[model samples]
Target chain A: MTMDLLDDLNRAIIAALQENPSRTNKDIGKKLRVSEPTVATRIRALEDAKVLRVMMQSDMRAMGRPLLALVDINVEGRPPEDVATELAALDACTSVSIPMSNPDIFCNVNAVDGEDLQRFVDDHLSKIEGIVSYEISTALEVVKLDPRFGKLRGE
Target chain B: MRLDEVDREIVALLKEDARISNRETARRLGISDTLVRKRLRRLSESGLAKITAVTDYVAMGHTTTALVRVVSAPKVAREVVEEMAKFEQISFAALTTGRFNIVLLLSARSRREVADIIHKHLRSWSGVHMVETLELVETVKHRLDVALVVRDK
Candidate 1:
């Protein structure tokens, strides 16, 4: 379902949770002028529909994986999707995607340290078949990482 | 900022369901509710963890997502990224060390909007030497519930 199908109440509930996911249903209801059960029901529906999810996300920088590497892979013989699937299986890779442009596959990985990153490139990345060549860009600083993508009201 | 065993356990429980009550978590972990509350508070305060809602851009009508690689002039990469980060359409932006100096993830309703963002804003910026848009065709995997597995050194 698209954002247009989602009612205002649903959007408001999502916004409230995005602002602070730890807030209780009762608190959200009070803040949004709705009942606690209403808030809970809306959240359940949203989750059931695969529209949104509330989960704990750890800061990789604070969790020992301070290094972020963006890799663009050029695949030759094999399908880029197959190569991306292999890369996604690795523990360090957070996201893997097939782009519609020059780079066949693009992925962002997190490593524990410089040594760990080198090991990942040498061991995992190098071993993947069909990878003709790849370029790795290390992020110096993550200026912004706001994951809330369903802000319907432009908040 | 190293997470101890107890902290890891708490995070694991919350990873399953961030909305889980402190009392429920405490009962499951066989710890006191006060301790669970304290640990969560500490984690958030220390900027080590966050309990937040992550939405599906596709389901939200943002069907197009692209990774924009920007090659900015030397000494202005950070400034360009900071400015791009302020836009609501761009979800992620950072300065990198490679051929492209800055990388950004843009999500919008359609490819037209993504192109507009690239042409109207990103290209208009003064220091932006070159811009490349890699539209994400399909997301093979996006593990939002990442495991808190800290490798022992």
Candidate 2:
């Protein structure tokens, strides 16, 4: 109801969602003693600010998903944008980015099976025009996986 | 979204232990278990966050871990990422600001395996200009900081 009430609630909501993105506002509101409308309003603001996004913590392994792959490419003449576009089109491509360098780009993708790693290499990486070379590394274990761009740590 | 004193308390409790249950959460916050459950559900579904099990990678078979930074041509960079995504050994990748354009998180059984990967996948690549590697020695702490929590007190 009050703007201060809204801000405090919003902070709590951000804290909650950051811990468990799957939580519902009703549950959040019930904990806050406020209407669900209040919870929803503040959530919209956080989302509009591009501070948060919702995604499934999917167990791709259950569906026989392959390892998480990271690839770096060296380009001779081709543009990173074109390479990014092609990579984004891949069935396995989860995310792609072109860094501020001549040809280096980073990508994360899901494979159907571990063997698909090679198919991904032969089919996609090799197909890019001017792809002088590419490096493929499969994740055997993920130690630290985080999405936060810059984490502010303080007392 | 307006949190009250109780809600702040809830955040404090969860920050201490994410595995805390609804009943315990309610008890700590002095709210009904139904309310605690309700709040947790709201927080998770809103994409604010989710409670999931995190494992120590070193406990597994992976004996080595490293970050790879690559420099390449524009055309090659995209292809490099797409192919990298398909690997069975890499779990993380990001484009960052620095001398190197791309960064990768990798795990392998031995130095030989890593060398093999570099030779077969990265070293032989024509587009790749450089690869800088850094091994992860340890993870001190990784998690979110609840804004409402007073840590110094």
Question: TM-score: which candidate is best?
Answer: 1
Report the C-alpha displacement of residue B1, candidate 1, in angstroms.
3.2
Q: Quote the positional error of residue B98 for candidate 1 in Å.
A: 1.2
lDDT for residue A120 in candidate 1, whole number 0-100: 91
Pairs clashing in candidate 1?
A: none
Q: Please state the error at residue B63 of candidate 1 in Å.
A: 1.3
Worst 10 residues of 2 chain A by lDDT: A146-155
Worst 10 residues of 1 chain B by lDDT: B144-153
List clash counts for every candidate, in order. Answer: 0, 57
Compared with the true structure, the alpha-carbon lDDT of candidate 1 equals 0.81
Q: Tell me the docking grade of candidate 2.
A: incorrect
Give the per-residue lDDT digits (tens) of candidate 2, residues B1-153.
Answer: 444566556655664345456787787667899888777666555444344322223322355655677777767766675576456566555444346656665667676776777779876769989887755433222222311111112
